[model samples]
Target: MTTAPTRFAPSGPLTGTVSVPGDKSISHRSLMLSALAVGESRITGLLEGEDVLATAAAMRAMGADILRGDDGVWTVHGVGVGGLMQPGQALDMGNSGTSTRLLMGLVASHAITCTFTGDASLSHRPMGRVIEPLSAMGADVSASPGGRLPLMVRGLAPAVPLEYRLPVASAQVKSAVLLAGLNIPGVTRVIEPVATRDHSERMLKGFGADISVETDADGARIISITGEAELKPQTIAVPGDPSSAAFPIVAALIVPGSDVTLTGIGMNPTRAGLIGVLRDMGGDIETLDEREVGGEPVADLRVRHSALSGIDVPPDIAPSMIDEFPVLFVAAAFAKGTTRTSGLDELRVKESDRIAVMAAGLAEIGAQVEEAEDGLTIIGTSGDMLPGSAHPIASSLDHRIAMSFAVAGLHCRDGASVDDMHPVQTSFPTFEPMLRGLAEA
Candidate 1:
């Protein structure tokens, strides 16, 4: 679906308690793991966004009986390990790269041949990162010329146990290999040179997998999973998505006198780098009622408007907040000094080239931004209202880019807008409404 250009102006003091959607990473894992277990698994707070729903649809097509009730709970009856039936047709993954890669792993050792397809955005993302690992486990694979989507995989029932080392720091690649290990006969090991998000490892343990993780002498992680195992079903309560919460949190920080409370956000250390970076910028963010939910850290964030100053973002923290850099760039544009970030080679491969997209958009809107091959260096406006763009910014079908620009609009003197708002539906379906609610309040 397409949307017309919508402009946003400075709305003073956005005050209210806001609850964002369920965590996308956790939500996708819950559904996939639930669909691989015996009996029924119930999940509350599943993200109903287009990307996550695409994963749900793919699971249902593979013989998992998935149902969502009027009470907002999702129930799934799995086909168990090595029990997935051949799908009747191609699996359409929509705009979710996570679904395509991870599902490829599940189908790698299932004795079934499946074809995966996706929208323009998802189809363009490289699938070779996942295909390489799964193929090492004996899956026959073929993809488009550039190893992009429109891919086919023929699983081998008795796949080989692999000891693959990650070439890049990717949670998706790490998770894909571990998932392919589920139906293999022996132990499958993955050597991670750099630490990434551990949602898969955590949720696998929660669902009764024989998974072990150890840190080596060199700080690399060695993760091993025993195959031919049975999975136990359990009730899962998803935490609020910190990635989605970033928009409003930064919104509250940049707009003077704005005070916003975001409740139930996931504070998983692997995904909390943005919070730490923002705090280091002198942002007024308070953690309230810290607790645990679904084996992950959870908290309510009380954010008030503050004077923010930019610093050199540590490159090591990039993996934790990979999905959040676009908004971080937005936050950087309003800071008091120069904000420089590097070691983000992965940004070039997202749904859109985030570094290029944000740099161009920010520059057009009167911010001094320098684009690099992997990252961007921005000279902030020093809390000054920017002379907003003459025309709408191009979002390039990226949800994060779309939302980041929307947040930038709140402080624009002439207001700001994007060519399309439809991309936000993939991760934050209520983003527009939520912003409207805050404005009206």
Candidate 2:
């Protein structure tokens, strides 16, 4: 695949009704859990981006028969729980950290040995987070130095069940441990000190797993799943990714006279923090048609141009909107006050160091930016607008960073350029065209 360079320039009002791709997180879990069931599971609204496609391919490699219809519905025929077969080759995870980690857990308790590899960006991400807990569950896992990818997971038949406490708030790590419990003979539990996305828990229950979640007195979540349980196939309707929606939502808010409607967005509370924060900053965001879709909360959102004010982003909301921070930073750059954020050390370890990378991008585009160990302080243009960057913003192969800067370009006087836009295909394959559709010619 070739990564082409792309640029976005200051534009007039952005007006359109659009729907982003299906939720990447849910799409991954749906494919994973569906592949473990005894029968075929049908899925609609699955994000068909490269990352999710990689998961579909990986499942097929492990003996699941997966297909996509002309209408975009996907069907998965499972090899049943504990029925995964050894792959003839290493699973190339592309740029997906979620798929690599979650599938590791799924493969851990089965009677198969799978080797995992990924693109340069993914290979650099730390997999030790999943490896540590899974090893405790008796899955013999080994990775490259620093626990990066190009790793191997040898499943433990009748894996040992164990209680593990998360050292950090990560849905991937937590979900991996829980998924590993599927083939174990006893109870498996994950104690998260701070909650992250619960797509796995919600989807697993929908798939007929014996799973339950309880909250500790301290507001932490304790998730438990019984092992050796048979999972029934489900008809899953994946919701539009809230993370993907952040792009257009922020773009409309910053671009003058813009009014855009994004429909079918997931309203999962844990994943909706960006919308709330943007609204608190005085963005004209409205939630419409609130309802449930395949067990996930979803709604359509209408956003119009509005003056924004930066505020202190509470750290507790980090887990909910972590992926949106890059774009949120772009919105802050065009706001009227100082936006300060902290308690986001996890951002340093994403596909790229989002805080540092975003700070660099903002700084390059002539915004006032201060970097911190765990946070960033961005002083906006006070609605005066940025001069935009003479140098192209280095995206570092992160799709969010690339797309976020694309939104930034919409509000800059000269627009902005990213080193490469191809990374957008990882989650939102149509990002460029979709975003361009709303821009004035």
User: Number of the top candidate by TM-score?
Assistant: 1
Instruction: Report the C-alpha lDDT of model 2 over 1-441, residue by residue, as the tens digit.
Output: 665567788768899999999999999999988899999899999999999999999999999999999999999998888889899999999999999999999999987899999999999999998999899888898889999989999998988998999999999999999999988988999999898999999988988899999999999899999988799998999989999999999989988889999999999998999999999999999889999998899999999999999999999999999999999999998899899999999999999999999999999888999999999998887777798874789999999999999889887888898899888899999988887788743
Residue 98's C-alpha lDDT in candidate 2? 95
Over 4 Å off, model 2: 1-4
Q: What are the runs in model 1 whose C-alpha is more than 4 Å off?
A: none
Task: Give the clashing residue pairs of candidate 2, or none.
Answer: none
Score each candidate by Cα lDDT.
0.93, 0.92
Model 1 agreement with the true structure over 1-441: per-residue lDDT tens digits: 557898988877788999999999999999999999999999999999999999999999899999999999999999899888899999999999999889999999999999999999888899898989898889999999889989999999999999999999999999999999999999999999889999999999999999999999999999999999799998999999999999999999998888999999999999999999999999999999999987999999999988889999999999999999999998999999999999999999999998899999999789999989879999998888889975999999999999999999999998897889898998999999998888778
Q: Judge candidate 2 at residue 316 and give its lDDT.
A: 95
Clashing pairs in 1: none
Q: Which 10 consecutive residues of model 2 have the lowest summed lDDT? A: 2-11
